[model samples]
Target chain A: MVGLLDYFRSAAGAQKGSASVAKERLQILVAHDRAARGRPSYLPKLEQEILAVIRKYVEVDTDAVSVTYEQEESHEILELNIVLPESSARS
Target chain B: MVGLLDYFRSAAGAQKGSASVAKERLQILVAHDRAARGRPSYLPKLEQEILAVIRKYVEVDTDAVSVTYEQEESHEILELNIVLPESSARS
Candidate 1:
């Protein structure tokens, strides 16, 4: 069976954590902190949809990604650090 | 200059992390997840007060020691693992 580290090192693991952190964090904050590394955005409706997808397909820890956004000189980017649940890592 | 590990080893640091995590998580979550590890609770009023105090004195990262609650066989407990910012720790 594939384990977490093995998958995290793989290509898919890297990108996914960044993207999902935003989603997980937002849901957590009762519709707040919808920041993708300081992006200007809001979408409860879209977020709900995404949550649906995340829930159905992935068993995200919400703990691992613990996403947060930051403001830099000019650009906005998504920052996430999700650790895939060992179970999810397999599929 | 004492760093995180030094303080964490101290008694104060250990207890505070668990308690603060509950506070930090709820605020960001937009009035959500106020669980003392499965205990019955709804604390918007108290929470706001705590936030006021916390913001006043400490520069809480609101990042590290991300708090969460858990449900067990018969009891509820708060779970927090806050990482004190270097600047704040100095004071």
Candidate 2:
């Protein structure tokens, strides 16, 4: 088997180090896995529906609305953020 | 400004709903931002150096080794996982 160092030096080109790349990939995979596995599948749907209802009253960027869950020990917190458009904010 | 629902129905084509896609992308971005912002810049480099040293003794897939820091309130946990090749395990 090729040693890790040899693989690094040869296959990896020993370039400045791809550790940041690996970390980035790992972070993404971990977050997706955590979200997909830990939350009820309906959460995202519920958020969308909530966004739908909220739209009836406000003119805003769709991307400005969000819903998320935060876990802390045995407690779970649901968080929402919405950014109003400048026209609405001004008025 | 586009109301959220109109934007969703038109821009998003009201296609089955891309809430899941948005959630997935959000999760990835959150993880990356958290990792990049919370940690010192040197952590990834240190992990690579440690991986280099470990390679001297074992034949293993480079990807099999990992280092991560987990947060729990004020406490920080550094975690490492390494899987050795079957040949090395047998010997």
Candidate 3:
């Protein structure tokens, strides 16, 4: 009887696993659609320009600058983040 | 007269400045509308969860983590950036 119950539990777990897989696939599809439809044309150039501007002031890796554009319901936020390396000059 | 020409030039400059100002206002309005319409409900929670997960291993400032969600043509990118403080242990 224990063996039989274990088999049923395994079957239910497998079903739940497949349901999660389907959900993941659907999310990917929706994300792809949104990407194709709504991305701004200026984003890449804007990021590059921002990186260049920051480079004028500090020595940083190419990856140290990040620019993100997010659209919100009442406003769009263009966020720029720069990670500066700790200066050895500081005691 | 040079003064008369200067006055006309100033008038033209004012008009141009006002045109740029109007453009800025329109951009702000459009941003507001987009912000109001389409931000994902899960974004803030997702950011907080990510920050918590990272904090378990490393000590970091609250502002040191940035989460950005960007949709592209073929994929959606959820970017998490963490600025780690320079470890004094490192030579």
Write down the lDDT of every candidate, Cα atoms only: 0.31, 0.33, 0.31
Q: lDDT tens digits, residues A1-91, model 1?
A: 1121122123223334344332211122221211122333322332333333444434666555444443232221222333434344213
Q: Write the per-residue lDDT of candidate 2 for residues A11-55, one digit (tens) a residue.
A: 223323544543221111101112223334333433444344434
Model 3, residue A48: what's the lDDT? 50
Name the TM-score of candidate 1: 0.24
Best by TM-score: 3
Of the candidates numbered 1 and 3, which has the greater TM-score value?
3
Please, what are the lDDT tens digits per residue for candidate 3 over residues A1-91? 0122223223334444343222111010000001122333333343454344334434456565444455432223344444445330112
Global fold similarity of model 2 (TM-score): 0.24
Worst 10 residues of 3 chain B by lDDT: B24-33
Off by over 4 Å in 1: A1-91, B1-39, B43-52, B89-91
How do the residues B1-91 of candidate 2 rate in per-residue lDDT, one tens digit apiece? 1122222123223322444542221111101112223333332433444344434444547666555554422122233455444334212
Query: Across all candidates, what is each one's fraction of true contacts kept?
Result: 0.11, 0.14, 0.00
Give the lowest summed-lDDT range of ten residues in model 2 chain B: B24-33
Best-to-worst order by DockQ is 2, 1, 3
As a whole number from 0 to 100, the lDDT of residue A3 in candidate 3 is: 26
lDDT of 1 at A7: 24
